[model samples]
Target: MAQHVERQRYWEAQQAARQAERLARKRARSIDWSAALRPVEPVPIRTETLIAALASGLIAALLLGDGVGPGLLIAAVPAVAAAYVAARAAGRRPRPWTLVWGVGSLALLVVPALRESAWPSTLAILAAIGLGALALFGSRTWPGVLLSPLGLLEAAPTGVRWAWQGVRARRTGNARNVWPVVKAAGVGIALLVVFGALFASADAAFADVLGGVVPDVSVSDGPVRVALFVLGVVVALAAARAAGAPLRWDRVTVAPGTPRSPVEWALPLVLLNLLFAGFIGVQLAVLFGGYGNVKERTGLLPAEYARQGFWQLLWATVLTLVVIALALRWAPRSGPRDRRLVRGVLGALCLLTLVVVASAVRRMDFYVHAFGLTRLRVSVVTMELWLGVVIVLIIAAGVFGARWLPRAVMASAGATVLALGLLSPDGMVAESNVGRYTEQGKIDLAYFQSLSADAVPALDRLPEPLRSCALRGINDDLADEGEVPWYGMSLGDRRAREILRERPVKASFETCAGLGTFRSRSEY
Candidate 1:
């Protein structure tokens, strides 16, 4: 009986110990919601930091008021410089890679100064700024790069709060150095105004020169300028805070998906590889056999054949990437054999997808050759080329391991976009159409009318009524542009103005009326 009682006590003690451990684990796993929800304290603003932020805001308001052009780069300079200065002052040295990205971002602003097209310039600027933000505030991970834009949005409120804190501190007499600078600036401005006015009134030529040099400020632009100033201040403060204390996205861990058995993982991939292989074989046949073979087999014209499958093949390539990602996620990693299986199967899949990418690109090229290049054609071809690059990167990762894959992919994308901006898609399209017209005696003057000022030089090469019709819209736009400040003029805009000034479009409406209506039957 005593032995039974001891056993019962032992069992009870064991149960009690297990319960305590479970409780401890539960506590460990539970998040403190209140602490997470609490607002973060704003970093204290130094006098120099406040001054830099204000100056950046003022510069943005003045320069950016004219719109995106050289002024954009001019405004960005002070904002980026201020951020770097603030970071250094706070003892936070930026990484060399981050500085590289920052410089790239600044260089991207040149797109606006160089290109008149809205879409390309806008995309480049957004990408540039986003990359800069990611470098400064985001994690080094791929997901972090994508989500970094959210960090900028969140920083808006923080920036406002930081600016307000600075204002309050100044009101509380914490910034004694600021008052002296403000007084000195006021005195300097007053002296400049008095002397400048006297000199201007003293000479008519001097007055005219002064009027030409100074920008006209109107009350109507007050709201716009204020908004621009706020934007500049907010962006600068965000960069400063991010450089000082970046978000700890690197600390966020993603749990791997449940691992599958080797058979379960390998089977689907093997089938996919076989399918890709089959499609590639057919593509090879079509490629070597040429358009005659396509026409005979498909009973479709070369252009029709190209157009019919290009989009589908492009989607197939994209979906193949998605499939590869999923396969990687659930891939078996239990043993050496499984690892080798992964490498081999995924490697084959990537190789086959590259062929598919090539097929898609070829189809697009054939179509472009037949129908001439348009914006959509150029865009899709560029996308296909980038996808090919991504496939190559994936293959590299499979061989070398994937730790650097995400970053490499992002960098490649940025480089591709930068290249596209530099290449000038509109100019390329116009040039292609011109060449097609020269060879085939077929042109799409109406389509050319839709192009931006980037097309002017190429369109200027066209003969007679075609040239006049193609240039009409651009010429009208330039004519209405009036006298813009140099900062407001893009390279494309300036060049187009010069070209039109030298050889103006002189065709009447009646002459150009029926000219643009010529459309190829295969266009649809």
Candidate 2:
């Protein structure tokens, strides 16, 4: 009986091994490639590649066309089409040639309009759009360039590579139940607090610390305040992380039945906007009137007077209320209609800006002269251009919006503007002008004063090296009058006298000889 039992066990073991082998073979053979490799969605043509093709085509058409007029329109179609094809082929990983074609096509789109009338403001708008496109193109390789850190924080969680890995690991036995995420959050919060405190403290202490002295009370308080703020933010972030909430980009998705209709969203935003308008109106009213009070008391620029202490608090309160109202309106419960209302409000706001600009210009003549404010006779021309660009972006947000024609036109417009800015006279203005001069002590006073009244203060505050040169120029004028005529004086004194001697070329004066011995003389 024992032998028979042992035999049965041995047979069972062999059968089990054979069955395992068969199962492995079956599993290998049953592998489905389509299921494994299928994309989540169909790949669309890349916007940049299309843009490039359109640009190139536009150029070719324009060059080859019979006349300037016909060539532009005929060229645009081929350019846009070529771009579309190239973009589709390039998809996620585009070729250099693809980009080249797209860029070339885009140049064609704007060359005709721009060549016809070289408008600066129009060109600026086109330039901004082109920059945006270029940034979008670069995003394929270096995604961070187009995205802010805040954008990354929001969008990174939805991405397939990093987020998917984490998700899959959790699903499988390889990872624990969200415990690692919590741990990471906790650790990140702790590190943030520590680093923030250290940075704030070090910055506050830098000058004193180098000299081995303690910072003042205010400086010492910086680290403590910064640490508290960082701690609060980290704690909030940790709490959110613990809740397993998905990161938000900008939009808040809502459940279908939640009162997400448009009117709910619109009302609050509308009210808030009106409140903002009222606040602005009141402030301007005060400004217009405040001048009277200050003028009566003391003669000063209109910029000098204000109820700063109380008015600031009042403005803050008003702004805070407006923000809260807007936020309440923006919540998901307000729905799609709310978005439309917000858009309308935005448009109205733009209109208000135009009105304000017009009023301000009317009040200030120098502003109109300096900015060339009324060539178009329309307020917010630049703003309108920006609005158009924003509209294009909105259209492109839809899946089908990333097309050849628009992208190409946009790209061409951009390249044309860029070329113009670099190669034209206006570009000279952009290049020559610096924002402001802050290195006061390094500049020469007399030289600076000679340039403009603005530089007088800066020149007066100059450091030793440049100040000496300035003082010498001043002293030279003074010394030239007192010098004796007997063979003159030293080289410095003679030079001073000569400088004093210099008159306008129109004022003819004769100088025969100087110095008692080996005298030298020059024309005056």
Q: What is the C-alpha RMSD of each candidate to the true structure, in Å?
A: 5.1, 26.4
* Candidate 1 wrong stretches, greater than 4 Å: 1-43, 194-213, 517-524
Question: For candidate 2, what's the RMSD?
Answer: 26.4
Model 2, position 239: C-alpha lDDT score: 20
User: In candidate 1, where is summed lDDT lowest over 10 consecutive residues?
Assistant: 31-40
lDDT of 1: 0.79
Q: Top lDDT: which candidate number?
A: 1
After best superposition, candidate 1 residue 63: deviation in angstroms? 2.4
Q: Model-by-model lDDT, in order?
A: 0.79, 0.37
Give TM per candidate.
0.89, 0.27
Residue 256 in model 2: lDDT: 44
